[model samples]
Target: MSRGTSEAFFDVVEWAAEQPWSSGKVGLLGISYYAGSQWRVAARKPRGLSAIVPWEGMSDYYRDRCRHGGILSNSFIKFWWDRQVITNQYGRPGRAARNWGPDTVEGDLSEEELAKNRQDQNIDNAANHFRDDPYYASKEYDMADIEVPLLSVGNWGGILLHLRGNVEGFVNAGSEFKYLRMITGRHDLPFYYSEEVEVQRSFLDAFLKGDDRVGWSVKGKVPPVDLVLRKGDVGFNDAQAEKAYPRRTENEWPIARTKWTNFYLTPDKKLTRLEPLHTPPKKLSYRALGTLEDPSLIQFTTAPFEEETEITGNVVAHLNVSVSADATGPTPSDIDLFVTLRHISPEGKEVFYTGTAGDPVPLTKGWLRVSLRKTNPDHPKHRPYLPWREYLSTDRLPVIPGEVYGVDVEVWPTQVVVEKGGKLVFEVASGDTQGSGIFLHNSPEDRSEEKLRGQNHIVFGPKFSNYVTLPVIPPKYGA
Candidate 1:
């Protein structure tokens, strides 16, 4: 699939360069699908491809879009495949009639013929479970091969999709003059906002036209990272309100001064900084096979803060967990852990962010399929706050009933300012809960009743301490 796209993009680039009216240097721009394809074609180093601005697009097809924590993200794939992809196929019969587009030039393809030509991503994704499988491997590319000048824009509220890819792409891409810009707002509006468009133009102009007005082409003249701080309850989905939040520049990501703070979870359902003082083992249980309509979960919350505390960057949850089968039911083979971080305002209101669909969401979300809990701490990308998982067939671990296993779950990166008297809540659930929006993982075949229906437990003891490590950012001196 990526090969076909890259070939077509290369052909176009070569064709444009030879035209009499051409500038001979091509730059790419756009958001979503357009931005995503830029990563693939740029990695190939096509002729005349000078620069790229992948605005809110994913780089890794498997990790960022198809699977989340090795669990198939079926809902978004279905929504995207049906409406955004299939309906626009080149030879669909009634496209002109329905005002979608013109019919095929030679004639429309029959339904049967069309079916043979295209792959249904929804079906293909659910059938393939690991990164090493041929289905996913064919789409893989090394971001380091991209040597073009790059500007990757990521949205903080796009927790379900594009956010991680943009950040990861900027980090891994071999571009010596790459920059990362983070934003906060609904997915579509922010990209077209006048301020954002200006940033995009200045970057493209500096690289493509050799105009270095903004110092983009001159290394060290401009900070490599531009971040939007999400502070205060600005109300979700309102662009103007979101603008009130401040912006800052950083020389590096995960900010070098980050204080990796651990907040332990107690049997009493509290999140505190102090470690437990010699307590007997305890566990909290929730019904398995939970759903959005009927969620089954547990929450551990922190007390009101004595002063303002800002939590920004990647988060990881270290938990000792196990699962048990119900009487007379099938044996449980796996456990799906859905973890969410929420902010409580000083007035006791839950602070929500603008999710991908403009829906109210918590601070951030993370997931893990217990059977795929294996991690490679030695991997170059692995960090204390963000553990790397290969999600390959060979990495699959056993999830036996009545056996406890310790796992580190990677929560998507996020930012928030917990005001004085405000609080933070750490929630663990068996299925999709609030803030999931359209990106859900509820496939009957993947999360079958025979496999996941059971009692999921979080064990707590001196030997098994459950805690969430937050990337706490202190204010810059004298700022």
Candidate 2:
């Protein structure tokens, strides 16, 4: 809720260190909530807090969990709260399964009671505070004050909420002794994955026990950012699929010698490094509530690579766009863009990976609303890879009816080794597309659904030309 709530954790850390049997050393561990708490509490710069390994936790509550680029991120939050939160209440059915070792039990609740006992998700309370409000900023972990060593665990699938924060924490944190580990696939994999677990163990060992081996360097437990990046075709091995264990170690973070490639958007729905010379189509339009198959969707694809190309870290789209009045929702004030990154095989087929819901999925995703394009000017421009994101505002600026707006759509980070002959596809739409699942809002991003009136466009050409900046990691550096 507030930074005030962050105080309890430090209180616990201090109490633990004061205990006679305690070693006067403390470290925070756990996945998701447990991991997220580490960032919040550590920001306080607690006395006994020794180290933290925040595994797949969303550090920024507003930007990550509540909304994405000013639109409501519906399903995940509701499902997470209703299915996971409500189901584990003190007296709800299946509650015992979450209890401690010996006290766990099996119990069934009557329909009437189960229904009555369940609590409302109260999700509106979060949505109502849109933007960098006091409530959310309070919950935000102060990266500047976190001086202790930390091992920021990350996931490609965690881009929806966890991935950005994990990487941001590592990059912005005040700690001099910090490292990052990014695995390819599943979100929960980092928790118990052997390789991931080992990374965690060694990190914890160096801090907690002052003794350890493996990837760990004895000097304050620091290790380079180890990414088990996804390889083309074969992808990650089967055992490492869910957790994304690499066949071999790859390059470090802030990838040295990054080759920034701009795949320019074209009117023909294809992308190429070469900028178009002729007066190509100026714009492409799509219904704000269009289906995944909407022909108006603007798509760009590059030719299959002739050699391995590794793409890691933030993938952003630099675009010039505009919106129409009464688009998709009740009013004409907003326009939503859901951009997806997909893989295509050389043999005229699309590539797919298992999703978090155990279904086939693709690489990563990004989103943005035109009016919310106000960039965080303070965000370092040198880091072209990371997106400059601020927050949604209820009284935010409105999109001009026909004016082309230059904006950067921050695609979530993706880690993959594209095999020779595998093509990269980028799609932009008013709403969700084929590969944009898991992160799906269930509800459309535009709120003016009543009249269903609006059309948005992605413009390209000499004047409105746009392109996506990819973080191309050189071939053999991490292979």
Candidate 3:
């Protein structure tokens, strides 16, 4: 099958050669599997493949699909492989069914039956062969070898599979000309499909087709390297059939002139920026609360704003943490931390923006699993984190009741300008707030169930400080 896949790709390249006035450059673009295949073929250094846009594609399935943090991520792989790969292929017939049979559905079945079949397949193929297995390693290509320009796109809400790879590829790829554009929405949202397609077309026209008009169009839409902030209506609509949003460019990612202030989370549930006079470490722990319908979590909010504040870019939450049971060792077990941004109006109204049009306004939001918080030194500005790591069950580092450890959380990217008198709020919890709906109701779960279900606590102290880092955009035109 791999041989056939490779042959078909080569045949496509051969077909490209027949054109009389062929442009030497070819740009590959697609979502998920279609996007994934581009990486597979581009790594081969195919002739005429000038640039590639791999949206929501994983470079290492073993690290991304089969396991996350050394724990099997079967639930995701099983569903994706069946829906996007197997079912689509097998639904046809002939050789397609032969190749994709076990991976796809052949007949109408209950959801439970389909899930069981997927789980079975996941177990059969699950292994840590990524490092030692030849087949797995072969799929893990060196992005450094891909010299062409690249526009890597990702979905922050797609916490399980696509998000991590898009960020990693953009940060690690060898291409000098690379850009990372992330949207906050559902994994299967149509905006991503249509909007990203437009972005790819404009990008390809500029670099691959050498179209100056399209190049200028693309360049004009890009915000300045510095922080730029523009507040207005933004959302997705099928009516505007363009590939990329008509973004209001800012001077920088997090408008530079804007001040980044820290509002500490107090033990008494107070949100203050003032430092404690003789602060000592404080510890707080909550048992797992809520089911798929209810949630056990903590919510924090600042007083109503006196003026407008526009926030964008990556948000980091630094906290000292520990776990109740040292499941892995003497040290406390590591748990995931979920953070969210909410807007409370003077009239006691709650407004939350999904970053989609017609939703309430959003300042920003972030999430981080304590153990999965490893940063990439290459792109410090971007602050990339990897969730795939092994655990040492023998060496327990249980959280000492009062000891302080720093946990930096990364929020999903957003562009929002809060109006004066609007309140900014932050919440910290142990479980999936989306699944349970404690603060804001996000439809999807960013982290996996296995990761979110673990027991953990957020420790605070004079030595252990917890605060949020916000990217503020300065006023436009030097105002």
lDDT digits (tens) for residues 109-215 of candidate 3 = 55555455432444444543233444444445566666667777665444445655666666566765666776654445643556556766787787876774544
For each candidate in the order shown, give its overall lDDT on alpha carbons.
0.90, 0.70, 0.54
Model 3 RMSD in Å is: 7.1
Write candidate 2's Cα lDDT for 319-421 as tens digits. 8877676523454555677788888877767766645543456687888766677777676633566656656465366676677788888887777777788
Which ranges in model 2 have alpha carbons more than 4 Å from their true place? 1-5, 91-94, 97-122, 214-223, 235-252, 291-296, 325-331, 380-382, 392-395, 444-446, 450-452, 476-479
Q: Candidate 1 vs candidate 2: which has greater TM-score?
A: 1
The predicted structure with the larger lDDT, 1 or 3, is 1
Q: Choose the strongest candidate by TM-score.
A: 1
* Model 2: residue 374 alpha-carbon error in angstroms: 0.7
How big is the positional error of residue 156 in model 1, measured in Å on the Cα after superposition?
Answer: 0.7
Top candidate on lDDT is 1
Error of 1 at 198 (Å): 0.9
TM-score for each model: 0.97, 0.86, 0.68
Model 1, 147-252: lDDT tens per residue? 9999999999988899989988999999999999999888888888888889999999998898877999998999999999888999998988988999999898
